[model samples]
Target: MSKSGITVNDLLKFSFISDPQVSPDGNWVVFVKRTIHKQKDYQSSLYVMNIQTRELIPFTQGDNRDTSPRWSPDGKTILFTSNRSGTNQIWKISFHGGEAQQVTFFKNGASQPVWSPDGRSILCTTSLKENQSIEETESDAKASKEQEKEPEPYITTRLKYKANGQGLLEEKFSQLVFIDLETGEKTQLTEGSYHHNNAAFSPDGKRVAFSANRSEDPDFTMISDIYELDLNSKILTKLTNSEGMYTAPNYSHDGKKLSILGHNMEYKGATLTRVWTLDLHSKELICLTGDWDTEVNDVAINDLATGAGSPGAVWTANDDGLYVLASERGNTHLYHIGLDQRITTVAGGKRQIYAFGLDQHRRQAVIGVSDPQIPCDLYHVSLDSRKETRLTEANQHWLLDKQVSLPDEINFTARDGLSLQGWLMKPVDFEEGKKYPLIVEIHGGPHMMYSNSFMHEFQVFAEKGYGVLFMNPRGSHGYGQEFVDAVRGDYGGKDYEDIMDAVDYVVEKFNWVDHERLGVTGGSYGGFMTNWIVGHTHRFKAAATQRSISNWFSFYGVSDIGYFFTEWELKTDKLDEPDKLWKHSPIRYVNEVETPLLIIHGEEDHRCPIEQGEQMYVALKHQHKPVKFVRFPESDHELSRSGKPKLRIDRLNEMAEWFEEYL
Candidate 1:
């Protein structure tokens, strides 16, 4: 009998492991495991593994969500954030295994726990108002209900007031504070309205380094600077000259140097994230990857590892250099970037490694990895010997009897002689020569790349005898900065041609792909391209646009990041050249659409607000064109990735049904 094929339902059966934390003693690793609960919601828990024997140990199996597991200095305890106590709070569980004890009871909740070097206290982040501190007691649930009954109106006068995930922003800022493990004493370290985040404690524990936009008129320039806070002297010194969006400040083993990551937005939204180093003694900051073209951060886009941690620079065992994530071509690799201006691939392959944690000695590491055939799993790596050991089979149980389609890498030249890369996935059971319907998958970001990561949606399509094509066209990050920025100001010009050329290349090279049965779908930026594609040509038989942008005119003020993003991506200001945005908007040429279209949108999506979907659906319908609108209530732009379990299934079902009906 043939093995079962991957279905949308299998999404609930798969376990997603992320944020691996290596124990200080280098004997074990801990990570968060997320899975669908009762097919209705997601439940995240903690699990530990012994490096020597690879024995899996279940720690927290409760119904509540647990995440961000961090090892204590002595390796006798584990600190994690969970909603087991009704709200997210820090909890500590002993290594011997017993009931976990609540360590923090902050009213605003806490996360990103960092233990002091001496292990006498712990520092964590929590949202706080200008006048508040971490010592504030947890708000009463009953009082919370009372306040909800009379929700306060949002009042803001700042450009950076709103965020996509958090919704209409408040005056609350993320602050770091210390908690005495013995007395539960709380001490606040950051203040003010601007966020003070990405903090790291010094080796001697006398100073704390963090990034914040504590500059004058922070809402305007919006540049964050690195600062060192003296715990005893209560003096704060700015370390960076506010040159870029520098963040994730990590001190060296000797605490004489700091490594940071971020870009100058020098190329606007398409600027590749680069690594930087700072000498604390001389106060000299050096751009480590200034001459390099590689992106110094994980830009892989996938739904498999939701809430996965993106670790910054990990110090080497000798502290002479650092291990950082670098994205090149189409994969996320661990690269060793040294102060001596040398960069080499450490742990790299045709796979996506989302998160990793190094031992206290920086010897071994535990990484979360996944590819087209693998959902998500943890692997242990020996830095000295370059040996990688699979620590867990998180989804192998379900995958063992399932038919997972692996993709074939494709490289083709665009019409402009630009080299483009993508992948082509054949149907689950392929024949020598058989025509199959093709579905072109587009990724969002326009800056983020569709890597060799596992996508459940693509697997579902492949299982249904449909060939899937996903490519990293111009404006995609894995390529160099020039290619990524090529789409700016030329939005629908070359980027659209790059995608169309890929489809043409596949149609000519792979005769199995039925040219007559071409369909296309994408979310966010991909969604925008879908709208533009269908409007521009009648080549695609059908198209599904999710969380798309139909009108850049309205997008200016409506989107959470619209005010600035519109200027950055389109290279046009709403006031100076409003028509330029409209010229590039997909909706401007809606009358040219001839393909049967499906519109999928999340009501709560703030990035490419639901209005974009409504406009596309209504415009096509008004012109008496083929179109259907599918709206997901209480869902956001992340609906397809980390939305409610049932809603995610419903989304896949809708798209599948649409393709089956049209293709």
Candidate 2:
């Protein structure tokens, strides 16, 4: 029998549950199940489970990967997208079992399918029409050159944020499409130069909702507003057109109101993305929770049978109420939010409540939770009985008596008196007196936070007998907006001091931490900090930076959203404010560096592209500093999570090995 212990390997193989859907009658639930196969070096698949029997079934499988599973309104079939057909295309399978059939035959791929209310059509978003590759005719070009002595006008594509994963900006545009279940005819609902993604059909089937940045803000990368489309006229109208990004829209069962995930631009970093409700007729928007800093992982817009307009909107099935995975006291937990807006804790500890969706009856829920030792697993959490039962036994057998250490959550004050949050882990068979090498792991985002979730990379450092320290320094979300925004324009100042203070605190408090053998590693913004730390101080013996930004001047135009995000964070838009962006750039202080560095980057990363890593590697080599570079091909900004799974594993292994060899 497999022991109920978490291991570093388990973190490396952790899976996720996303785009959860409940059947029409709420009797069955279907979701995507991801598993990382080290042998194959990939993660893939979709799964279904009966709410009543808890009998798990794998719906689609093969060499082709499948995901984003949604049940048809009548609940007799499952609609999903698969790469099994060479490219991602719509495919369906009977819930009763047997072979899955391909649905849409369009050359372009489709994803994120939603079933229309009457079950006559399926609503989804696709770049098929928008992605037409055009070749300039040689004859037309020759004629134009002879006639006007001017170059032929090739197709000029104008779109928002297309340079990332999907290379080459073709004439293609992302739009909403409706497919007839019987006739198989496809109707383009909304069309234009604007990109439409992550759409959902209204409960009444009269409208489809989506997120887009149609307004003429060349810097509109951050403004993703919610829009609703009229099915009859095929006209699109804006719903929530605020300054911030509005996403994850879900229609209430009654069709009178809509629930959506909203991120206000006023603040960034580890802040909360709240769940807001808007009345369709009145257009009155109401903020659902005051706990704004806490993340609302997934919300179900349920119209309860017992209470209709009870303010909090309680949905009870199997005697349980609405539950949300809320972060509190440094950890995420399942909580019951009552119709009266009263909150009660269900489960709390050092764990992550990644995702959850209601079952058919609305009584019990299929919950996905994970900790340091366990990868995510689905469970049935009863509302009335307060009982949680494990559902799928996916990779439970892989963990056999592997020992892992639980993190010691610690709070320390920076030199400037700002409080910082961190987690430390010692060796599994830790020795009290012997000083162990320490590794400081920094999280990216500068706006993102370092939560107490199961992280494989950090665990590996611990397993290799290195004391690990990771913290939410200035600018990390999870705290209030002011705290998160504190790091802006002050990058290497207080934030750097804060990290140095953390090392000071750990060294003083923990007698087992080796002061001489210190190392640092981080990705993206965290990677920037890692590079910055080594350049400014030689305290760390070694360092590894991933997908980092070495120079702000080049990053502004080279990265996808760097032009906007860099300006926003640095409070400067152009070279006129060169001093501001430069003061915070890591390359500015490379002359002070003494520690050896390893640079890892994704070749196609648009967020903080490969150039950032190249600049650092070139500078270090010129400075005669010991350095190395590892570039992953065919990867984007999400190399850690969505890059080639095997490559991600190797990336982590390489970082660990670098520190082990140098530190």
Candidate 3:
């Protein structure tokens, strides 16, 4: 009884898959299954699948989110985090099947549960206020007293005081915690005003390695160094130099070395992440992908896979090398890195392998993949035979009756002779000789890549009889480091040309595309481009910009990453480059915009801020140009990807109608 194609509300029917954890013996895989709850919110539960039979069984059916499933050493028990008790906490369940038992009762809740090598204790992450002790639990008598106090003014002298999703940064630190499985006793391992993440225990279970910024002025100096802590002596040793951003440290199987995924900030946020190995004994660090141009991580931009855990370096059983995901072109494929620095693709293709869990024996892996046709599904991949077995088809039921719009790859050359690539999805159920309007969709990150991964918005656009054109300009990832870093210091110069050229290529090559009925929309940097595109040219009949930056001068003070990102990307600070900022601002040319523009933004968006949308809307309205503004409350930078379900549907409807009206 469902529709033939994907609809705006059909998003509720799709199930998101993420964070697949393979059992030790490679017989089973437990992963997080996320589904929408009638637009109220999202529900995430853990599901276990037998590798051989491909039979999926419900493991945990928590009302709220239950994630981070890890197998015990002996594979008899599984440790995970759940929020069925109102807050996320550590929980354990036997492999044979039974009701889950709560393990940690931290007052702030605990997550990122990692079992120690001996399986006697578990290490997790928990946040604590400056004065609050880790001994504070839900059962503690002091918890009730502390909860009664009124909120105080936010006092902070630090530069980094806020994040996008999480509002004002509290005076809280995510410290390392250890909960004993046998005694059920919790102990705080690290203490400071800093946060530690990506923790892993040494093979002997005698030491712990984590990434943190323990340097002076942790806010101003954006350096994350790897550190090792001796569980016995309680002595912490700084492993890497405080020069660049480093994270996701993994200890070798033999406990002799550590593999890390990071970059030296050569291009700042646009820098390609490379794999590095640190000799724990010699304290020497080496980048294995130094000569390799491919970025070492999943760069595919996916909006479907919620809570998809990122893959890091997985040590081989023999300790000679490690397996990691590499982003080359538009696809994220698994690659093996040997000690000799040779990188070879193990499982690859056009699909986006977002999350992967290795077996460590070089035998097999469980990967979460999403392509243009598939949302996200688990697959069993053999590292030796290179055979792939489809594990779970979470969206197969409804997808079987839906007509998916498959994207055809497009490779074109920019006016400057720079090579560029993108995809164009024809209108679903198209008929020959019938002209259709084209909608140009731009991606936000300017730093992230938009691959052939399943995009919900793109599907909806194509389903509604509009040809969708999305391409990677110069600043997209999956390309080499130089191509991604090219947009820096040239926001609207060549990057704008690359986008325009893609549009030109599609319109010229396709006979069914109507040049007069063209529309454009994008968010963040893409939003900026949409605003810029309308101002620079009147080719687009309609335009919608979401969470966009209109004025560079005002954005420098309002945005969360405005100051440093301006310096890194724009190559100038507010004080030093006022004229340069004004020159690049789309507001400077707002009077030239003739297209019917719809300005969409999130009220709580600290990243781009709603003010940007307001400025663009006001400028256009003052000039009597066709413009409209719609703001989403209680949403931030992640509005399109993970915003409120109702708001996301509303956003899609707003854009589709806007295009349908003028185009």
Candidate 4:
């Protein structure tokens, strides 16, 4: 059995599984296994498992992380992106397992390889522009050789003001590259001064579909036009010209129509990614799904190759317009899409739906699922019979005696009578009517959702004898578009009240919560909220704000995704609306803070810079408040999940210690 209460070492050894890729034949699945290394920071590798035999094998093993595995047309080869070659590049290997071969060689890097339908080529995106190199000039060198040459302007100009992961003004562009499988030659497809991504090949091998924000929409970074490429003529044609962003294009097996995901102004800040199909001949666009709230996570069309009893996804040669897609209906699940665009629930529940595959007959499908107890396992499901067959015993034995807590869904009404939803995990050894210290766990994204799935942090709190409360307040994503937009321009208003009411509800009704000895913590936007909460109210005795945003002014320029996100959430552009930004800033209300705040931040976090924490620490110390700052050297914004193993463990230990001392 695992040790009780999270330890520094336990945090270091934790690993995560993501990006599960199922092969076309429905025989194997490959996925990325991420592990944190205390010394080096992050480590990951690719692993493969046979669906029929239930045999698992490690594909690539090294110090560097390998991810984004894509299967070739014949299913005999696998292509993945890796940093083993000193930079991220496409690497290929046979399904039989042997020495992996590097596919692309460039000065910068390339990733996300997708195969062409004919198996003759592959498509990958590369951001090749490098930062200008400053050559050191020596005084002793020949001065005459450098004479009479006019200096070129070093200034770079681009209309794009904000980016998702890279904040501030972005002047660079990413282009698509097509690589020949047989000759090993490569050709750059799209060029000029705009970013293009998410390329998909047409089923007939004649054209390719991609999303791009070209010279058409220079200022609006969110407006992406779908383009179709005639592979033979090297000509590009516009498919959908709109004022919103469109991505993840997929071609029907017959190549007569195209389906893509799009988000317009009506979606607000969240992605109401609905499936839209375009007719190639008529140039008419058809909106298939009416519900904009139901986001289509991943999509695939049914083909003749689907297995028996499978949902007959329109992927193979079968003329049936069937497809299998995944969506977040409470939890992630695979759904069967009929010819008329009707959706039927395929497989999903409290446990996560990682990935799925269907054989030729479309009668059965293979699913990858996991929970708090089971890491991830492959299961065979008959779409017709609805029978599930467990194929892998990967974590069966290890989870046999695991002492994990089942979180109970709890709801409470805020002061404004708005219904707030959340989950609470009692101690693993829960006692009846026992008053225990509480830990209010907050989620980041301010836009991201905290689902019913198993979380390591919640388990750690349960083992530490603290009642963990995590909720989906007004700003969470999965609760529809209106709820997500509620926090926009109104930070700390209703959202804070909802959280406060949640704590009050638990304290008043549970009788087990020691209201006076409560602690609060969260990261990213959640960290921002934590800082905001401790400043506005001192209901909790202690607080741990990890990767928090204490100041909105600095955050607008410092964070990678802040340039637009800041304006989007605060409802104002920087320099243009200073007062509005100040009104939403937590630092503005720091004068009312009484609770002890322990700040945990990463040294190299580009999302929320370290200075945010430093300034908060300085302000608190200057005011003579009980505050402490802990910095993890050389870690990014994902420090809690992907930081250095040892440092992450240290972070959790420090947080627990802070609450242990004050709460």
TM-score of model 2 relative to the true fold? 0.87
Whole-model lDDT values for every prediction: 0.87, 0.70, 0.88, 0.72
1 or 3: which has the higher lDDT? Answer: 3
> TM-score for each prediction?
0.98, 0.87, 0.97, 0.87
| Cand. 4 Cα-lDDT | 0.72
Give candidate 2's total backbone clashes: 12
- Give the runs in model 4 whose Cα sits over 4 Å from its true position: 1-8, 36-42, 130-172, 216-220, 298-330, 339-341, 357-364, 368-370, 392-401, 574-576
RMSD of each: 1.4, 6.7, 1.8, 6.4
lDDT ranking from best candidate downward: 3, 1, 4, 2
As for model 4, its CA RMSD to the true structure in angstroms is 6.4
- Among all windows of 10 consecutive residues in model 3, the one with the lowest summed lDDT is 302-311
User: How do the residues 1-663 of candidate 4 rate in per-residue lDDT, one tens digit apiece?
Assistant: 553543345444445555556677777778777666545566778888886787889898988878888778778898999988777888999988789998877545687688888778999987644341112112212353448778664453443443323444435568888989899778888777677887888877778888888755556466788899998999899888766777767677778877666667564566555667778899887766655456555311110001111121234345434454444423556765544767777786665565666654466676766554555556788778888888665544544556777777787788887777877878777789778899998888776666655566777778878889888788776556677789888888888888888998888888878888899999988899999999888788999998989888988876766677788888886689899888888988888899999999887788888899998899999999999989887677777765556676688789878888987
Error of 2 at 475 (Å): 1.3
Supply the global lDDT for candidate 3.
0.88
Instruction: Name the top lDDT candidate.
Output: 3
lDDT of 3 by residue, 514-608 (tens): 99999999999999999899989999999999999999999988888887888888999779978889988999999899999999999899999
lDDT of 2 at 395: 51
